[model samples]
Target: MTPLDDGPPHGRGREIWLLAATFLVAAAGMVYELVAATLSSYLLGDSVRQFSLVIGVFLASMGLGAWVTRFVDRAVSGFVWAQIALGVIGGCMAPVMFFAYAWMGEVELPLYLFLVLTGILCGMEIPLIARVLKEVGAAAFRFENVLSVDYVGALAASVAFPLLIVPHLGLMSASLSFGVLNLLVAGISLWLFRAQVSRGLVVVWAVALCALSVFLVQSERMVSVVEASLFEDEVILSQDSPYQHLTLTRFQGRTRFFLDASIQFDSQDEYRYHEMLVQPAMALAPRRQKVLILGGGDGLAAREVFRSADVAAVTLVDLDGAVTGLFRSHADLVALNAGSLNDPRMTVVTGDAWAFAAENRDSYDVIIVDLPDPKSIALSKLYTQEFYAMLAERLSATGVMVVQSGSPLFARQGYWSVVHTLQATRNPFVPGGRLWVLPYHVYVPSFGDWGFTLVAAHPLTPRDIHLPDGLRYATPEVWRAAQVFGPDEADMPADVNRLQSHALVGYYSAGWDAWFK
Candidate 1:
């Protein structure tokens, strides 16, 4: 009878353990990919660059491993033993990779090298499993069936990881759990395929045990090293959210916040920047009763908005729930902002800013664009004409919008392109109105001195400016002078940028390209 029949003493039951081993291997291997991609983005600044390169490197290494599988002795014991080694390495993948760069500083070189090594070793598992699965049946349902099931397992893991695994389990726990799964896989293989194992397999089991142990003890150290390297201070709080690593660290009594690898704020002196961002838009806005705040999860900008008693409703849209939730939960933050997040008038929505804004239109009088600098394409879209048109649609004819435009002197094209974009959106009624460009600079501890450009639909005269009684940063004179730019920062050429087709990105590239080089 065939192995499919349940009546057998050995046919199907024996092969069940082997196939389960195969499934675990596929799951574990894919987890390795996820860990590498996610961790690199967390430790490094650029998400696109980190994810794409690691995927390419891992795939190439897997192919090389598969090719090398041809020459090795195809003993099932030897193959299983090597898988144990891969698990051990991959077990430490997150913690090791997390701390690797901070400890060594050669993150690029050894990171890719370890990735290739893990991929090669991981790739070796399926081919060897297929060979063993072939031992059962030969004529019709044989090696091909086993291979197809392996593919199905891969498909399941790919879906489960981003949706079920990451958001639910987070990094440290997920890595530890997968490490246990891999070890469990090795132990089961040793039991089910006992006749196939060797004396050398003892070392393999020992290594997996060691990795599991290391993952438990030293993972916190990994985070500290990563935090220290990424931020110029001691890390106070760090979390691996489904979306990114949420980190709050301390330097010189000032607390700094980060998402993934990008600095969100240095809380000690953020008031200077937040005050400028919100007050300008609020002052010029025809009515302050209805307001929309985009991407100001820190609530510092929201705190500024809450200052005006005239405001009736404040709608805050930020992507990460963790950020806003922290603002709501932390006693210090809530007290600092006068519990602005929990204020009866405030509404917090967590999700993508682009999608959220698209769904709601013409809903508010004032919109505050308080986002990080446009470092990647995701952020660049917010600066696009399409997004600006949405903002313009939502604006009351008398209503005004202000964006936290990046540094003009640094990304002159980037700064001016924003202005050009605001002008480019063609509507029959509002062909083009008036534009007022106010460029200003502030010192941030993490980013050093930075710049922003404030624009308005109507001519915003100095006579139009006013602030609440409790402001610490801006006075009437300071507000007027804030619009003043120095000789070098002011002398932006005519060719610096054209409307709609923003030269800001190119300008920013030229300015910051040297640091990357």
Candidate 2:
């Protein structure tokens, strides 16, 4: 007959409160992990690698934390202090990383340091809570109960993070808000077990809570200042959509659009890019009545597509509605695209390009793949062999499809991988059961040495295609030179990008790293 049989007078109430604290700390721990992973992905280009490293390092640190808790003789005091430490460290993680990246231009050290510290603190929580629970509990199964509640809280946090937290509160506010929760758990635990915690510890908890509250209140301004430092131009629009962060900046009458801190286009010379992407396919296709544009949410490609009067109906599939909405409604953005998004011939679908291509029965005479670089898994799927096969199914017999491949000079292997993937695609209308691909590149001042791939059933060359009027950069001579890759920019051996392998992402990452890093 020990404490298990005859527990404290209010043992049941104590168990419930301790279990609640366990649930809260677990949720806060998961949120901090997510915030770190997301922030790293935002600052770094390769999301898959960044997320994998963050999660792996965090889980390992947690195991280390749990192992270290055995040295603590006082579980209640240990748990409360760990919570206080986590509250301050985890809460300030994102804002600090943001500022570090903005000012220092390198956050690898800070990112990993915060990750390891918060993960260790999070790891200590469960074992410490279990020990405290056993002191006042009636059964040995209290550990299992605490573990169950911890898992449920993690599930809740994972679900809410992508759906509610990131989109609504953003990374800065979300981290600070969860930090507040961590402090609340600490303060509540201190009050519940007042005899166990000293007065100094209680004062520490109060100060942490008040400081986090101030940060939460001023989180928006803090983010604005930090983000402004990251860019040279004045940030006019900064928003976090479900898929990615969309930012618009203006400098010297030129507007630039960025997604996840990567520049998408500059308004001054966007025509060079858009014209090269859209005009080649439109000119080569035997008929250009129906057109489909994928991933060009800014409407710049659509503006080029509408240049041809033969196009009767155009459907643009873009993942982010915020992007299309801005281009459609905002006076400055609309003027940039010449109101192409609001054109009567345009029908915008705010959904995934792959899903739309898979489900739709309509065939188009021209299809333009104007998506971003394969910096992440999400974008990598667009460059996969399976996705190209799907597009081939929706392509009319005489239709021409063009893909905006990455820079041929900078990302030579990545550019060739797109060509190889398209070449591997089997189309019934083609003679060899393989799509005919003609890889070409153009030099845009904003984005140097970019490439595009034109695919069709039959063999086609730039000489046979007709150039449209009112074009700024692309011309018959420019088209010919674009096809001629210099000896230095010659094709490289690469693997075809498939859904399972996503080999293109690796190629893209390696190429960019060599040049930029």
Candidate 3:
């Protein structure tokens, strides 16, 4: 009988261990892939494109590794070495990419290089493990056992990734921790099959373990250095929440909040953005007793809302708990928003704005959709016709909703597309059915010629404008002039942003590229 039928006495037990190792390595491989994709999306824009390229390159490299495995003669030794290589590469992927992007102004080279390297190493791993298992009395079910166990591990990883790894350990720690797992898998496998391998491998293993241990403890230091090189100011706090990367920076007492590496607001002039976002809708609404804010977890808009005496109750729905919690607890952040989030009149709900709008039975007099710009497919959903339709259902008959449209001078087509989408939902035949929508612009020093869209079920005129108390920038005359646009900021006809088409993303991407790039 061949070694497949009659092997060492403990071969059967080793085969089970081999399957377990396979499960672990598969999970580690997926974690590395996802971590890379997420980091790329944070550094770069357009998550859909970033994830697609990383996955495609990784899978193809895996296939390449599998094909190259045909030339290997020693399966067990090859598998052990591959695991060590994968551990080091996967463990260091995040810091390496961050450094590459911050230093080189391009992540494409290192991103694909690591993907190919890790993919090939991961690809070589399974075939080698399967080959060794086949030689050790598991030949009859090697293919079935390996494939099934690999798939189960992948499913487990897919579930654990978002729920556990991202929220708790974060990208940097998760990568290092998985690397340790890879090292352990390799070390244990080598020890179990020591008689079949040479002694030189032990020295390599010892060095790698020591290096990884030191790196793991200093991961935060490395991340801080990388972020310092990348961002303009000193990063006071940088964390990876389940939803996005949150960074708070301070330069000469000027604080800036960035989500996914995109600046949300700068403290010096934030009032301009928040003031314009809140004032128009609150002023125009017939009643301001009930208000709904779709985003604005920062509480700056809530601060503006509290300025109106008519506001009895305010409901703020934002997806990220980290942000709202930060504003609530952080002394500086609390002071920035004038303690608006802690107001007894405010109720903070940590959930999806889209779902909250649909399920909410209560009608709101003024709804402020202070969401991020349509930079990705996920964010684009919030700006679509479908979302606007749901939003319309939650508004009182005389309510006005203000949407923060992107820059008209920079993203004119995108700005108008939001207006067109809201207009598409208007019903002209019924009384108070025809939606009266107008496009407006405000010039903030931080953001040039920013735009907003105002919508109501009935006709809106100067009579609807009611200036709130303690206003700094916006007055009744300013509110009237905000509706008028110059020749350069003229409105343009664009397709409505529909769920299927994602026209806004395309328009915004193209428009911003032309103006900014």
Q: Candidate 1: where are CA atoms >4 Å away?
A: 1-9, 142-144, 167-173, 221-234, 250-253, 409-412, 427-429, 432-437, 462-464, 491-510, 513-517
| Range of the 10 consecutive residues with the lowest summed lDDT in candidate 2 | 1-10
**All candidates in order of lDDT, best leading:** 2, 3, 1
**Model 2: runs farther than 4 Å from truth?**
1-9, 138-141, 461-464
lDDT of 2 by residue, 1-517 (tens): 1243232336677777887887788889999999999989989868888999999999999999999999998888999999999999999999999999999988899999999999999999999888887766545554678889999999999999988898898899999999999989888788777776789999899999999999999998998998799889999988887667888999888999998788899988899999989987888888999999998999999999898988899999998898999899989999989899999999999999999989999999999999888998988999999999999989998889999999988989999999999999998685568999999999899889999999997786446567778999888777778889998788989999998899899889888899888
CA error at residue 465 for candidate 3, angstroms: 3.2
The residue pairs found clashing in candidate 2 are: none
- Model 3 Cα lDDT, one tens digit per residue, 276-356: 888888877888999999899999999999999879999999999999999999999999999989999999999998889
How large is the C-alpha RMSD of every model relative to the true structure? 3.7, 2.3, 2.1
Would you give me the overall lDDT of model 3? 0.86
Error of 1 at 391 (Å): 1.3
Looking at model 3, the pairs that clash are none
Error of 1 at 301 (Å): 0.7
On lDDT, the candidate that comes out on top is: 2
A best-first ranking of the candidates according to their TM-score comes to 3, 2, 1
